[model samples]
Target chain A: MLFVPGNNPGMLLNADVYGADALILDLEDAVAPAEKDAARVLVRNALSACGYQGCEIIVRINPLGSGYTGEDISAIVPLRPDMLMPTKVSDAGAIREVSRMMAEAERESGLAEGTVGLLPLIETAAGVERAYEIAAADPRVKAIFLGAEDLSSDLQAIRSKPGGEIAYARGRMVMAARAAGVDVYDTPFTDVNDEEGLRQDAELARALGFTGKAVISPRHVEAVNQAFTPGEGEIRYAREVMDAIEEGKRLGRGAVSLRGKMIDKPIVDRALRVLETARALGLGGAEHE
Target chain B: MSKLVEGIAEAVRRSGLKDGMTVSFHHHLRNGDYVLNMVLEEAARQGIRGLTVQASSLFDAHLPLIDHMKSGVVTGLETDYMSGGIGREISRGVLGQPVIFRSHGGRPEAIESGRVHIDVAFIAAPAADPLGNANGVAGPAACGSLGYAMSDAKCADTVVLVTDHIEEYPLIPASIGEEDVDIVARVDSIGDPGGIVSGTTRITRDPVGLAIARYAAQVIEASGLCREGFSFQTGAGGASLAVTQYLKPIMKRLGVTGSFGLGGITGYMVDMLEEGYFRSLLDVQCFDLRAVQSIRDNPRHFEVSATRYAGPHAKSAAVDSLDVVVLGATEIDTDFNVNVHTDSNGYIIGGSGGHSDTAAGAKLAMIVAPLYRARLPIVVDRVLTRSTPGKTVDVLVTQRGIAVNPLRGDLEEKLRAFGLPVVDIHELKERAERVTGKPETVRPGGRVVARVEYRDGSIIDEIRSTEE
Candidate 1:
């Protein structure tokens, strides 16, 4: 996932070219509150002007509590993005309210009732606490993401270097999303200059069970992609595992060994999954899909 | 003091039968490398024992050389890089002494310093005269620049030029001159041109890779280093080339020209030079066809011995003179340490190459990669192995966000000021761990398969045989 400022036409136009599975046109943190209206207009125009190819475009509108939320929804409903990202979602009530507003906006805009889905951003202390409830609130919610900066600020917690302070919240968001049977994504890492740090954080998020992450800069996406991709050694090992399993099955053996390493049906199954995921992401080889 | 012979067997005999002698070959052929096995087969026929094989780099096609290593005909080895077959064998501890690996620049230094004196240098050229004047750009086997063989020809006591095409007397525009040639022999085919171009070294079309390359190019441009007289180095990969291609427009638009470029010079570098992007090219090795022609025709395309490329003690290493270097990776840890040697399964498929030397030498070392490859994370809590120490790696660029090592705090501040997406490395690792599940530790057998040596010749990490 890569974030493009909703107000920046250049960024929004180039978002699909960055290989982000999902492009979040952010109207929340990326854009100043004063530019909220302008950002919505720019985002809506961008969606209407250019086809996003196959990229999942999600417009992250301001919180429902904000006055511009209704306007933002109304402006974007006509353009029809794949999903709407509602920021600072505190509870299930907020999601339900946003879904209804989106429905109303769609109706008024002459669009289909379920034209756009919802991806909630759990930012506040209350949001993290009610993550599971918020994720399960509306069927329209496809994923839930944790916003570390806002959560840290709301909790009055010290923002640790490298985000060690917010590790618990990030993990909780993953568990909540998984329990709710929806994908989870980590928040945008603010320091784009620290490429290694961004990579480390993304790796941590991947390990913590987030399906993907929200990236604030183009530089971060490659590391995020690499952190998620399998290495050549892993692919070779996976192939070996599959080969051994096939041989084992042919010999009526439940398990076998290759290069002295044990290979069972479960191991083969995991290997197949790795290959499948790699192919799905267009990352089976060194080249991008 | 006698003239060398023509056949591989004759060359081996003329070099004198001995239990141990160092023989060297170059990797100008890349995967098309065929000289090593041919020479080893002759040595085996003569019952040569304890032969120390020195190569510029080893590829999968050189796997047949392993039989000689196991048979005690070749008991030692030295090279700048080892990948695929040779890498697996070394990682399995099939050889007696640990293979000594050097950077592309360091290999020549070792030879010149008498640390690794070569007894004989067997060069495989595409075309050569009987007197040993040879060129790689004019034959069916044309692989490219003999940048790597230049050092061996100068430092080795004896030099043998093996070619598939023996041109007329005094082959004009010689890449390796007569002064370095002791003998020239004809072979069926010096190398397969098809194999030379097997790997893609063009710009990446993948959106994520392209974005990282662009951002890296941006960082280079923003650093105020993409101007006239700036020198740069790029790894031999598609994305690195993409970074170069991305920088071309920016450089052209700014009217910023460079004095020189460096690293594994390819056609892309040649094009840049011919187009007046750079005044000169410091080529340590030719990676493709165009570079060979450039080296032959363009006097400005100067060839430098490996010693001058990244030798720690060279007066001024080529890498040391680089403004920026874009590299690839298999895994990078949060501490900023990079692993290009071992894989997630703890098997080896990568080599040291110039990874550490460039990281430690270049003004800006940017590692470009996607966030995830094949479900397994490329950024780990701890890299399976460390080839380039994190201290030397300056910036990490990905499609998601950029992370600058804290050591470059000022640069980080500058990028942040530009409104770039800067994040801490630890945060990135945490996020990855959160999704992938923490990596479980794997116990290895007691035997050590490979030992990763830092540029300073210190052991940084060791890979043990996988426990079954």
Candidate 2:
């Protein structure tokens, strides 16, 4: 859902309506090399002027040392967007560089320190290897997203439909995120018309323990969100399990059974996590996920 | 003995538009019409406050009403349609009171029944005599139909005519005759004639729009309604009008001729009539120049009063037999309640217009819009405002899928059997959400500014004030 091109004002204006929990106004990849300067200016103006129908605003700048990333950061940092996503981030050095520039810009612009967070797109083999270190590099490095297209291209392998080729890298990214105590986003599904494909990919990414999936089209948002969020049956089971486990514990029993399934500690823990995930997904009460 | 006055202020004084009273205006001149703004400005200058405006419709040209609302010169609004300028501000909660929406026929019926009393009525005349006989056809700003203003002239306590041209006494062929007038105030120009009718009424070529139009036609065809002598109505929106275009081929293929095309007549509908698709066009409001000339020239192209069009009080209005109406929506909830009143951000960019009325009366009421606009999902948990009831809404046609209300099991069965992309409302909501993520629910702040009045005059939903 976060694919508003920096050059397109109409896209930027409508970015909120598509309900991308966060909108990444793209300053790189989406803009042509010749139109980079114009796109930067338009994105800057839109950031300062247009109100995003309540979606979290994130601006994805071009890679560091690309000559445009510096300008993009300098132009957008003053507006204090929720986050800045620097594409093709290979190591902690690139993150540190962005952090320094953002700090300098934040100070110069009179914004509070540490107001802007960083979302580094881990695309290279080197970045995937250094995921945990890069995520733990800066306090502002809130989330690490796996750029599957770039990573797959770097690995010189064709992407499998069910994500077999990207599985190792995705698993490593997820573990690294957990180790670093930060969120990790899966790569965006590219085929806009393929809803089933998007849904399967999102479900696979969610199963692999990614926090959220990246979105190329606004159409991909719902699938990713739903895949990441627990559903009604799961929520009901989690609630009942939690309630039963709580009752057993109150009665001084070490374990309990519901529907002939062993209600062990790990199962209880998983149920708690499920309920927590549901609550965080904005699903409230015992009704349903 | 003549009713001609010096200015709007003089006319306001004559009509007794005091603090805390209701005044009315018509939108036949549409976006080009200047009388509403002129009269409201005069009212604001007169230090009038807490006044309600009962307009037949509002256009983008009435942006000045925001200031009037802000300054408390005008607080409430009652209208059938609104075209975004004042609407966006109102949705952001600019008005202290909510704008009541009535149908085209309901507006007049409300006035006549004393449900809504107008202290003064301002008619934007193209030409009016000193004695206050006015007609739209005989002036520089001819808008073709003054149907919306007729009832206001009859029911308002005092009636004021604001026109640019001053004809001699007893203007001939008066659409609004002299007997209803108390005063006439001449202005330099009522408004730009070109700006009166909308320009977006053309059949949309956008493939998404075309796909939706195609599906809507198929739904109508599958509903077992598109036979010979079938009747229909649609709004002046690009997508809605596109349904008119796509339906032509289907109607031609089926060799089915329609009875009449109703509501705000457009050139597209006129073309359909001329092409032998429909027998006649019953226009309450002419939307384009071709329609205007057609009404003036063609015997088959006729002008109908608002009462005869969609009046709830009528024995049977034109909407009663409406086979289908393809309308657009800002949002539609899981329950099938549709909101045309506000955008996804809860900004009032539109009003009910004929949305609820046609839905109530039409055999098939299809809410046609993209599943998601911009990045905002059109299908939601609950609409921001319920302009039309769920039971009245039969089908929702979007580029993504078509949702038939559970109330219409037959519609669902028919659409599914025809191999249409029939999905449940909940499934459509999920389909929309699966792509656009769940939008942060927009909650209007703690104030009720307006109530959506169903065609039966019952409060269907309340629009809350928002500071957005």
Candidate 3:
């Protein structure tokens, strides 16, 4: 995922060139408070006119509690982004409120109900504590994202390096999203210049079971992509595990041995999940053993 | 016509038997240099004693010249600097005289001032005719610039153009014109191009080097210098080139356009220039075939002489106008004193050619290298030799971390504010020593092989040879 400032027409026009699977045309945090209305209008026009070239475009609107939330919904709902992200979401009530507002906007614009999905950004200590409720709140909610910078600030914690801080929040968010049957994403790494740091953080996020990461800079996209993709070695191991499971089934056994390592149903199920994730991420089709 | 001399030996005899005569050579062939040894052998055979030898720079291949210096056939040596075997011999007082070191730009200045007049200048041409018109781009050992030899050919009263591949009467686009030539001769092979390009010139993949490169690029971007028209120059080294690679994607995303790349040209720089990332490439010496081909095909690739490249007095050298210059270091003390001449063992395996000149001139001078090499720590409590003054080197980038010169307090503040991974030079040295045990002290034998002179000709440090 890549974040493009809603007011940046140049970036919006060149979004496909970045090779991002999805783009979040951010209306909050990126824009000045005074220019919120203007940014909303620009984003609406960009979505209406510019061709996204097959990229999933998501419009990150202001929180429902903010003054500009009504205008943001009224303006962007008609344009129809793949998803509408609510920033600093704290609980189920906020998701429910945004869902209700989105439904009303859809009716007013004469668009179909449930057409736009919701992606809530959990940004504070309160939001992390209630991530499960937020993920389970609305059928429209598809993913929950953990924002480390805001959480760190709210908690008054110092993050010196990768894997030291934010590990607990990242882990909790992924677990909550998985339990609620929604996807989870890691927050943006503000240090655009630190490629190694970015790679290490992205790898950690991926290992912790996040679907993807939000990148502040286009330079971060390639590293994030490589981190998420399963290499040939993993694919081969997954195939071996599946083959062992099939042989065990033929022999009326619950487990089997592959290269002297015992393989069970859980291991076979995990291998299938990897193959599915790889296929969904467009890595390659799984070859049966 | 005078009796034709068969080899360099006969040519030296014909030039005249004399003591105290100044002879010069060019470093066009770089480390693969063989013409220096070939000529010195003849000088030794002719019993030419106490003759002063002036070359652009000494390389390991010219180690055989140590015999000539010890036998009194060579005495006063003047060049940019000496390295490897020649430097070791000179440090032992084998020549019985102090060696004079000059900058890449200062060599021309010294010759033009008549301070170091040349009696005979022997130029190794890759391809030349009998009348002495030569071209470096069309020979077996083609090293594409004779810029180092231009001053010698112009100032010397007797110029001998030696060629391995003799072409027709007129070689097109002659680097050294026929009017400056006094004699021409053909030989088997001038030198090997393979040896010239032997040093490490690729991007370093070591974790520390990559870390430093990343931080340096970050510093550049955070300083707001990632905008359009930014100029850069990285020397021929793996770590320096890694900076270029790291900067490429950032520049593309920022939509920043660079004006030009300046240095001893390499193929990597040529690719950047051709990719339209940079508007032009200012080449002083072509390091490989890609640069030579780029110079031949692309008009944007301009070749300038050494004086124009970094000479302090030149109307405004290319290096002086650079935004950044990435350099390599052999040793850097906590005080930031840099030594590109001697290793941790105090063995002279390198020179100070253009290292100091560029550091003092460029806007941001960064030295990127490993903290230790071959279990010898490069970041030390005190440098064994001081080639470039630490005050001029703005930043030291190692695999461990980056250390900005405290003199640039504003830069330090800005870098820290940007969340860069920065550490003090001393801390970096300590970390390096922890990984590779502290280097053993090299005992200095009381003889000086070469004197490292500051840009103003002040003796900063004297290079001593390793005791046998």
Best by DockQ: 1
lDDT of each: 0.79, 0.83, 0.80
In candidate 2, which residue ranges exceed 4 Å CA deviation? A1-289, B47-49, B167-172
lDDT of 2 at A191: 85
**Per-residue alpha-carbon lDDT of candidate 1 for residues A1-289, written as tens digits (9 for 90 to 100):** 8888888765665577666788888888778878888888888777876567768989888887778788888888778888999888898998999999999988988887888999998889999989999999988989998888888999899886578778889878888988999999888777867877888887888777788888877767777888877667777777777767767789999658888877666776768867776778665532322
iRMSD for each candidate structure, in the order shown: 9.7, 10.8, 18.3
Give the Cα error of residue B363 in candidate 3, in Å. Answer: 0.5
Model 3 chain A poorest ten-residue lDDT run: A10-19
- Which stretches in model 3 have alpha-carbon errors above 4 Å? A1-289, B1-10, B198-201, B374-376, B433-445, B465-468
Q: Who is ahead in lDDT, 1 or 3?
A: 3
- In the order shown, the candidates' Cα RMSDs to the true structure are 23.4, 17.0, 21.3
Evaluated at residue B250, the lDDT of candidate 3 is 90
Report the number of the highest-lDDT candidate. 2
What is the alpha-carbon lDDT for the whole of candidate 2?
A: 0.83
DockQ for all candidate structures vs. native: 0.15, 0.02, 0.02
Query: For residues B196-265, what per-residue lDDT tens digits would candidate 1 score against the true structure?
Result: 7533356555556787788888888766677778888887675777888888888899998888888788
Ranking by TM-score: 1, 3, 2
Error of 2 at B463 (Å): 1.5
